[model samples]
Target: MTGRPAPAVLPPSLRGWLGLVAAFAASVVAGLGIRYAGEGEPGRVDARIGAAVDGVGPPWRSVALAMDSLGEPVGAVPLVVAAVAGCLLLRRPRAAVFVVAGVGTAVGTATLLKHLVGRTIHGGNLSYPSGHTAFLTALALTVAMLAARRRGRGGLGLGGTAAALLVLAVALVAGAAMGWAQVALGAHYPTDVLGGWCTALAVIPATAWLVDRIADRLVDRMADAGRRGRR
Candidate 1:
């Protein structure tokens, strides 16, 4: 019988996972700082920031509304579905699963934490983590990760790396804009948004790792099947 093809190692290296862990740790620390701050300093800061945003000219109001809409369930859910469909069309079922699971977990975790923490500020209920921010950030990061993997396979050439970086930069910008828009609309505190982002930072890489493991197993099985057929 022909020998099986060796199992593949997932592309995102150990150091990459470490970086995500560090980011998650930092976000947890930041969330705790906001949570325990006497009289809610984070809430106060959020209010000031929101006021500043409100004062940033009339046209910006429209822009903020537009950005905020991107995070709304009506818009975000459909976009995520479309993205998953696109990934499936590209024959990356694992990537598509990652997108759905990452976003779902991020949003669900934020909701659970909000309820568990029971934080309220400025007459808002269960406002610790911004669900909208978490959803958008997770979606953006998933898209970037899928795009990078799709294009980064050939080689880590300068061109591929540059393209990946460009995609990441844009995704980050869009996520940040959406988060800030949440603050501008008085829907969530800045710390809430930060918590959402941190949650996504923790969830996305971990999800990717899980999906990669499953994909690796499937790939190994396929390779083994082909080897047997050849024999």
Candidate 2:
């Protein structure tokens, strides 16, 4: 047929997007698992949940609270990536600006959810939609979107299979590690991370597509303006 590679299939579709939303809702339910399950006697889930709900303890407690501080690393990360993307743009390089924008979207969404959803921190804030969880999930999403964009580029042989596996691995690891860290530090009820991941998974794929359309239009407009200015 034509020489052009088959148009890359969008990795996620409408049904898939809805499924992701359902999954996030499921995560919210699952976050309560530690509350019911995780049998470590009566005080197990409660103790940890209480800790997170109450916020950090005294000075000593704060120092040891790496999980709570996971946001620090997450926040620091997008900055560097955004800067790199900016550099690429400066050089007229085809860098991924969507990835940076995606992080911003996650952050903005987290802020809105934190206030609007009225979910508490642990008790007062609810902590159902964790910022820590959102941050990690968003990072994984960036990797997955970038990988999907790269598909069918060189060839779809063994190399392609290996590459796909690698991309999935990266996304899973990043998402999972960040999620677990929050759980470990007792900063979020397990459900919070689950909801966070589910929400992110649902949103990122559509965003990737939307960013492409918007960027293309901006590029076209820029070219048109350049032509008129040269007249």
The top-ranked prediction according to TM-score is 1
1-231: candidate 1 lDDT, tens digit per residue: 233232122254333543555376457936654564333335567767767764445687788888777777778879999988987776666667888888888888878777766667665466767788878877887776555543343323233455446445755676588777877766777777777777776776677667677776777788788888889
lDDT of each: 0.66, 0.53
C-alpha RMSD of candidate 2: 7.6
Q: List residue ranges in candidate 1 displaced over 4 A.
A: 1-10, 13-18, 21-26, 33-44, 55-57, 150-168, 219-231
How far does residue 12 in candidate 1 sit from its true spot (Å)?
3.0
Instruction: Give all TM-scores, in the order shown.
Output: 0.76, 0.59
- C-alpha positional error of residue 66 in candidate 2 after TM-score superposition, expressed in Å: 4.9
For model 2, residues 1-231, the per-residue Cα lDDT tens digits are 112212222333323443454466455544543343323222465457545544445663554365446467665575547644643544422225555666667756665655544445434544655676666666665645444344243323324345445544665676566666665555555556655665566455556566656656666777777788889
- How many angstroms is residue 48 displaced in model 2 relative to the true structure, after the best TM-score fit? 11
lDDT of 2: 0.53
Which run of 10 residues does model 2 get worst, by summed lDDT? 1-10
